[model samples]
Target: GSITHILIFASGASKVPLAGFQGTPTITFLEPGLGQSLPTANTCSVSLNLPMCSTFNDFSEGMALAIACAKTFGIA
Candidate 1:
């Protein structure tokens, strides 16, 4: 099966915003060097705030989002 959803855990210091492409709430990544582009076909991406050296409590948000995403895509 193909990947339907993606969850990205980025550092709090990163400048990337926590939203989808063009503020539409659709997750995507772009990297010209890697021959990547935005608006991945049939893919939903989400990025959560996660700082380095964080505790378990800090993982709650990401985990919650992951579950929600899974349910949204009927994965859970």
Candidate 2:
């Protein structure tokens, strides 16, 4: 099976920001409404590498983003 999304949470700072990273495939399409429904087909895969998120509040924020993404993709 192919990967649909990749969300990475790192404790240290990344040399390159997530928006500037060029290693991952482009996510050409995203589900509308932010957190509404599932897509009928796999449009593209997305990768998000968030760094320096070691604190409790940072972790919470990361989890929140994860949950929001999951809900947006209808996976949660």
Candidate 3:
């Protein structure tokens, strides 16, 4: 199993509810979306080491991107 992609999410200081996420692959892919790059950059700055990933500000868009990737990779 391998992780083909990575996605990070930011609610932009907004209230976001916590939820459980599941993936069929052995590797995990975080939420995917497009938003302010600076916030993501800041996040990465503190992240220490990350191989690959993208960031998103909106929930729906992020989920859509994640779903697309899952479909492309034959993941449920």
Candidate 4:
């Protein structure tokens, strides 16, 4: 038998004074698309610490990024 699990972490602030995002490995690779809205306010900092057991390649990473973004920010 085999068991697997994936963990995704996302955090952000609302109404921040200044600054955008620090950019993580997944974020750097995904490169947030235009028109994408984050959960936090315009002036806020959001973060996601996603974890995947397998399929951690570009494709999976992209999918994970999208899922995380949408789930956190309610994107589509």
Candidate 5:
């Protein structure tokens, strides 16, 4: 089957604001470069924290948005 979409999301769990963002962003899928096939429907665990006005709810929403963007061009 053909590829669907590509996604890249980062999480900052450190109590520090900017510092956390700079550090390792509890990645879900690593090395999912261009021309790669999309991943299956599943949830990825991460220990990163959400920024202001950004909670688990917001993160989930953002994830959806990213997926949509990827589908637009079939990044995978």
Candidate 6:
């Protein structure tokens, strides 16, 4: 029903966060802005990346995350 947690990726950025972050990250679920460009989830395989983002929003990140989760969980 919500993102239990997540790690966002930018182009040319590190894929993994630092070893341990015990605190839950405070994040904002921004709605799609006016014709904003969304990048493909290149941080990992689509299957491994998208589902982590789907439920909270309906933007490009959500699409990418859903694809990744479906791939990993086999629930397309």
lDDT digits (tens) for residues 1-76 of candidate 5: 1122221222212133543334343533424234323322222332322222225565455555645553433234
Candidate lDDT (C-alpha), each: 0.34, 0.37, 0.29, 0.35, 0.35, 0.37
Local lDDT at 6 for model 6: 31
Superposed by TM-score, candidate 6 places the C-alpha of residue 32 at a distance from the truth, in angstroms, of: 3.5
Cα displacement (angstroms), candidate 3, residue 12, comes to: 31
Candidate 5, lDDT over the whole model: 0.35
lDDT of 4 by residue, 1-76 (tens): 0011122233323333266346532322223444332222221234343333234474455544454554445335
- In the predicted model 6, the residue pairs found to clash are 46-68, 47-68, 50-64, 50-65, 50-66, 51-65, 51-66
RMSD of each: 14.6, 12.0, 13.7, 14.1, 14.6, 9.6
User: Which candidate, 4 or 5, has the higher TM-score?
Assistant: 5
> Mind giving the per-residue lDDT tens digits that candidate 2 earns over 1-76?
1122232321112244656544453333333435423222222333332333336585456545554455345335
- Candidate 1 — what's its lDDT? 0.34
Among all candidates shown, the one with the greatest TM-score: 5
Candidate 1 per-residue lDDT, tens place, 1-76, comes to: 1132232222212234556244333433333345321122232333432223244554445445544444434335
The segments of candidate 2 whose C-alpha lies over 4 angstroms from its true place after superposition are 1-53, 74-76
What's model 1's TM-score? 0.26
What is candidate 6's lDDT per residue for 33-67, written digit by digit as tens?
A: 43433323343331122223344455555555544
Full candidate order by TM-score, most accurate first: 5, 2, 1, 4, 3, 6
Model 6 regions more than 4 Å off:
1-24, 36-76
lDDT of 6: 0.37
Give the clash count for each candidate.
0, 0, 2, 0, 3, 7
TM-score of 4: 0.23
